[model samples]
Target: MKIVPSSVQLLLERLRATYTAEEARLRLSRQAERAPERTLRSAREASSANISSLWRQLGAAGVEIAGVEQELADQRTLEQAERYSGNIEAMVGTVKLPVGVVGPLLVNGLNAKGLYYAPMATTEAALVASYARGAMVATRSGGVTTALLNEGVLRTPGFKFSGLIDAGLFVEWVARNADELKAAAEATTRHGKLIALEPIIDNDIVFLLCRYTTGDASGQNMVTIATDALCAKIEQDCPVKPLHWFIEANFSGDKKASYIGLITGRGRKVSASTVIPEALVEKHLHVSIDRMLAYGEMANLGALLSGQMGAQGHYANGLAAFYIATGQDAACVSESAVGFTRMERREDGLFVSVTLPNILVGSVGGGTGMPSQSAALSLLGLKGAGHGAALAEVTAALCLCGEISIMAAIAAGHFSSAHEKLARKR
Candidate 1:
């Protein structure tokens, strides 16, 4: 479907025009003339009347923000945000993303089993509805099965040597002292466990990607700190150190797309699958299961031809909403959404699955503790260390639901119509 690009200029102009009422401008001018020496900040500090007068001055100054003013009309206070975030400035109210619940999406996972009302935060009009539709069909078909297949957070520390022999010798030394390196890494964190050290050997350079299993947390920060300690230990202990050594040669796949993440997986490696009964497919999705399979074939061909990272439909649509609602590091969406999804004709119905190798999500750290984010997680029955594994599985399940919905839309040729009806404001 074609997406209409938003114009920041146009939005700003509307805000300006909407709030710049002639009466408001005139009232502000009279007030300003009455007390030309009055300052807005002092007025705002004085009383409610002065605050109203201050807003008038801004409006009279040609700033149109009546809508924004109305939106922040009852802003409680900004002081509390400092607990969850750093570098606090004045509280800038809120950007109220409409949150919608999809499901009773039944999920069977190692940690999470049962029905959930998945909270999705998004601006797209039909996104929540689409996911909810997929969830309904999946629920009727007996739910998605999710597995936490693997877990790791990586930090690749690089070493430079004079020659191949020197680099090879360093690699040998590191391997010989693997236990000590592991100890050094583990010493830094109570929850992080040093699981493996994977090496990439160039002629005269070596990159040791340290992998860790961080319990119940995404553990990017935990893994990075542990890797730093390990590197320091190597510098101090390895007598035949490289001519130079540095932490993070960029092979760890932090906050960016890389083959390393796609292959090795930097966070939770999760896979979710489901079988939709034939009757349910046509009844709920309004398309034949075989036609969905054909669309999948076309999409896979296109992904292969275009060298796309993920061979799936609309993984980002669900993942972005999920992450934003849950207060996950939304940037992780870049890596998390690169999913491998498949659909095939089955004897009874259609078999579908989504494999998300690097689903970097957490229920404890980062934005999960913030009020809105916490509420979203709580809505899903996920909000702490114990729920991390379940969160990963749920993420995979949600991705599968989205893949089914989007592919069905494309296959049925209703993608554009759906968007035209739902995306545009009436």
Candidate 2:
């Protein structure tokens, strides 16, 4: 979506509280006069000496410097337009499964740059309204748009390296006895491929990690089956003695118990810790940094990691809705949800930002090609691979906006004003 020019004007209104037409026009003129290129230069030039000055400019102009960085990154994403042609994209794949509770419907503005959400599925219907109110709250607090902003993606490859086998013997076996091995593996109705990977040890077993793009599905199971078939072939072929016969899959390392030896147990509760800047608390722009730090100390940031809350919260309600509307493995949200939200004093106000590293989101292939998902993709004006990352960047921005809005309300003691009319009547 196009960035609105009125966004800056709205922020000025919040800061000035009230403004004449002339004042509004002047603010707009100042922002307009600052070229996008200059904004980039200022961000790049942010130094200890002039950092305060640069921050004041951003605060007064209602420009988020970090958001600009995300935008620049998005504009440079690898797409067909970038002319990166490789079979790797075609080789990697994904799979989806059903698991866990589907909690809460969230909402955010269409033009929003980040994520916003409410807890409890019962509260889902009100999510959109809450964010809209939140948007207004932010606008009044020198904020401009109510939308979330995200602009990038992260992809985790589906394969890992394994130990080596006797390359000379393995090659000889493949060449001399290909027909026999193929016939035996076919007995079990297994489809497989033979590829010689780089060696590991001094020849214990021919270790091959099967890697392939499973074509619009989570390929974990398919890879496992194929690997098992190849293992059986190795056992039969040119074997001096197959010692150290072990299988590792699911991309987890040898540290985890083997699937055969694994004993399932009840899941454990999660706990985590994080640091928050103290200056934001002093500005009444946030809860006591101590409180957030305490929460982290007590529990892992799982709930906060999802939906629109906490630092690094992005993925506008639209993105989640889009994920659901499409056939994506929404539970993948678990890994994709990990990120950081940071607040620091900049000039007289606060500068807020978020960073998400393991946002294992995908765009093309898999459910993205489904009919419903295709329609949702159309709605966001997205096509091909990098849309998921773009959605994520927008989601993170919205999440930061929500936290900032709530923090401002609590600090100003106006957090409960939304229900004031009913409270007064009672």
How does each model score on lDDT?
0.83, 0.38
Q: Residues 274-381, candidate 2, lDDT per residue (tens digit)?
A: 122345344434455444444433333554455432233333342243345444545554443444555454444444444433332344554556444555555544
Most TM-score-accurate candidate: 1
Tell me the TM-score of each prediction against the true structure: 0.82, 0.36
Tens-place lDDT digits, model 1, residues 1-426 = 635446876785786776767755765574544554643442213233443555677677667977866565334323343443331223334467789999899999887799998999999898998898889888899999999999998889899999999888888898999999999999999999999997789999999989999888888788889999999998999877688888889888787777878887889999998999988989889899878988999999999999988788888889899999998888888888786999988887899999988888888887787778888998999888788899999999998888888889999888888888888743
lDDT assessment of candidate 2: 0.38
lDDT of 2 at 300: 32
- Please report the candidate that would top lDDT against the real structure: 1
